[model samples]
Target: MIEDILSINQRPKMDEVEGVLFCLLNMLFYNDQKKTVETEQISIALGKDFVISFQEDAHRDVFDLLRSRLNMSNSKIRQRTADYLLYSMLDLIVDNYFIVMERLGEQIEMVEEEVIRRSNTKSLARINQLRKELIVLKRNLAPVRDLISGIIRSESDLLDDRTTKYFKDVYDHIMQAYDLGENYRDIVTGMQDLYINNVNLKLNEVMKVMAIVTCLLAPATVIGGIFGMNFEVIPYAHHKWGFYFAVGCMLIIPIWMLWVFRRRGWF
Candidate 1:
C-alpha cells in the first residue's frame, strides 16, 4: 500500500488488512500561480487508536482546519475516536473538491460566454482546453466515489458505527461532485457543437456576399462583351456618346441593383 502511494497515476481505492482501514485517494487542488489543477496522492490509515495520513507534497495540504479542530479541547473531533478523525480528514478532502469545482466552473462559464458572443479560433482552443481539464477532474473523482462507497460498506472493526454517518455524509458530497463533473462534460460538448455551427454560419455569410458581388458585375460583363465584338457595323458604334453611354449603364445598373437589394433588405 505504501508502494502504491509512491507510484504514478494511482487510482483511488480502499482496502482492509486485519483490523486496519486503508484509503488511497487522488486529491485535486488549484494552483493559483500556474492557473491549473494539480493532483496529489493521499494515503490514509485508520487503526484502533490512531489515524495516520501520508501526503505527497509536504508544503501543501487541506488539513489546517482538521489540525485546528484537533487542538480544541471541546471539539467533537477531540472527543471522538480515531474513526472520526479519519472521517474528518476525508471530509476535508471532499470539501476541497467543491472549491476546485467552483474555480473550474467560473472558467467554464467564461469560455461558454466566449463561444456564444463571437467564437473564433481562440474560443475553440479555450473550449478544448476546458474539456480536457474537466476530463481530468472526472477521472480523479469517479474512482473516489467508488472508494467512499466501499468504505461505507466495509466490515472493518476500526470504523465506529457512530462515525459511519459522517462517512455517509462524505459519500453524498462525492456523489454530488461526480454529478457536477458529468454536467460540465455535457455543457462542454454543447459548446463544441455551437462553435462549429458558428464557424459554418460565418462561412455562409462570406459566400452570400461573394454571390451578390458576382450578380452585380454580371450586367457590366454582358454589355462590355456585346460592345467589344469585332463587326464592321453595329448599332450606336459610331455615336459620339457611345463610350459615355456604356460607362453610364455600367455604373447605373450596379447602383440600381444596390437600391433594389437595399429596399428588399437582402444584404
Candidate 2:
C-alpha cells in the first residue's frame, strides 16, 4: 500500500463552508450524561485507485468493516473499480447514520417520559439539548446531500460514470437523515412545551394551596386583632374560657375549609 500526506499549509484550507455536503460528515450519537444527540465528523478523500479516510481520533473509525472486506480476495469490492469502493465507504457511513438515529429515537422517548413524570429543570435542559442536536444534524447533513448532488452533476473525472449512480443512492440516504432530524426536532420541541405546561400547573397548585391557607387563617388574625383593642367592650372579652373559645374558633375555621377543599377535590 502507498500513501500521500500533505502538511496543513500545503493542503487547501476552507475559511467558510455553509452546508457543503461533501466537506462534512454528520452522525447522531447519544450522550450518556445528558442523553442527548451529538455529531461526529469523518473525512474521505478519493485518489488514484484508492481512498484515504481521515478521522479525528486514532482509536475508532467507521471503516473497520470495509477494511476487513478489502482483505477478502473474493469480495466484490476487490473486483470492482476504485469508485465502487468509495460507494461502499459512503454506504457504510449512511448505515451508521440510521443506527445512531435509532438510538437517538430511544433517547427522545425516554426524555419524553421523564418530562411527564418530573418536568424539572434537568429534563428541560435535556430536551433543549436534543433540539440543539437535531439542528446540528440538519446543518451538517443537508449540505452533504447538496454536495453529493453537485458531484453527480459536475461529472468530475475522478468518479467513474458507473460509480456516479451509486452516489444518487447516497444522496437519497442523506435526504432521509435530513428529514429524520427535522421530525425529531419537532418531537423534542413538543416535549419542551409539555414540560413547561406541567411545571406551570405545579406552580399554580402550590399557589392555590398557599392562598387557601391564608384565607382560612384570616379569621384568626381578625379575632386576635379585635381582642388586642384597647376598647372596654369586646365579645368574649369577659368570659373565663374566652381564651379557649378563641383558640377553638381558629382551629374550627381551618378544619372546615379543609373539609370543603377535600369535598371539591381541590387538593
Candidate 3:
C-alpha cells in the first residue's frame, strides 16, 4: 500500500508546481541494491501538483505513525501539504534516539556492576569492548543530530513554518541523546582508572609481605653460613653436643629478631 502511494513511475506528472519535495524514508528499507542510507545526501526536489517523496527503502520507514495518520479518512495529514508529512517522519526518528539512549544506559549500568565486583584482567577487556561500542554509537548519532538540526534551520519553502517547529522538537531530542553518549563515555573511562589502581594496590601489598619475610630470615641464614664453613678452630666444633648447640643458636637468633621487630610494631 505504501509503495503504491510512492510509485512515481506509475503516476503521471502534473504541470510543474513549486512546493517542497520530501523523500523521508530509510534507505535500508529499500532493496539490497542501495542498502546504505546516506542521510547527508538525501534527495529533495520541487514538483508540480504535490510534493513527491522518493523513499529509497521500505523496511525502516520511521514514518509509520504518519502513515497511520494519513490512512485515517479524517486525518490532518491527508488534508495538509507534503511538508507536514515530512515533519511527522522526522519527529519519529527523533523519538527513536531516546529509545536508543535508554538501552545504552542499561548497558552502562551492567558494566558498572561488573567493574565493582571483579578487578580481573577479564573485567578490563570487557570495559574496552564497551568503550568501542559507545564510540561507534556516538559517531553514528552525532551526524544524525546535525542532519536534523539542518532540516530545522533550513529556509527551503518545502518546510512550512509549522513543520519546522516539529523539526525543532526532533532536534532537541537529538541533543539529549548526544549528551547521554558523552556521559557514558566518561563513566567508562573512570572505571578503567579504578580497575588499574585496585590491581596496583594489591600487588604492592603482596610485595611488602614478601620483603618482611625475607628480612625476618636474614640472621638465621647468616648463622647457618658461619657454621657450615670447613675451618677446624670454630668455637662449638668439637664438643659432643656441637650440632645441638649450633641448631640452638640458629633458632634463638631468629626468635630474638622477630620479637624485636614485633616490639617495634614492624609486624
Score each candidate by Cα lDDT: 0.89, 0.72, 0.63
Model 1 lDDT tens row, 1-267 = 778767767888899877778899877898766557888889998888998888888888899998898789999998989998888998999999999999888888998999899999999988888888888898889998998899899878888888889889999999999999899889999999999999999999999899889989999999899999999897777899998999899989999999999899988
The best candidate in terms of lDDT: 1
Q: Candidate 3 overall Cα lDDT vs. reference? A: 0.63
| TM match of model 2 to true structure | 0.77
Error of 1 at 223 (Å): 1.5
The regions of model 2 sitting more than 4 angstroms off are 1-41, 259-265
Error of 3 at 178 (Å): 0.7
Residue-wise C-alpha lDDT for candidate 3, range 113-228, written one tens digit per residue: 88788788888887787787676556656766766766666677666787677777777877887888899899989989988887887898889788777876776688778877
| Tens-place lDDT digits, model 2, residues 71-180 | 99999999988768868877877777777778778889999999888888899888877777676566666666766676677545556888887989988997898789
Scored against the true structure, residue 206 in model 2 reaches a CA lDDT of: 92
Ranking of all predicted structures according to lDDT, beginning with the best and ending with the worst:
1, 2, 3
**Lowest-sum lDDT 10-residue window in model 1:** 26-35
Instruction: Report backbone clashes per prediction.
Output: 0, 3, 7
Better of 2 and 3 by TM-score: 2
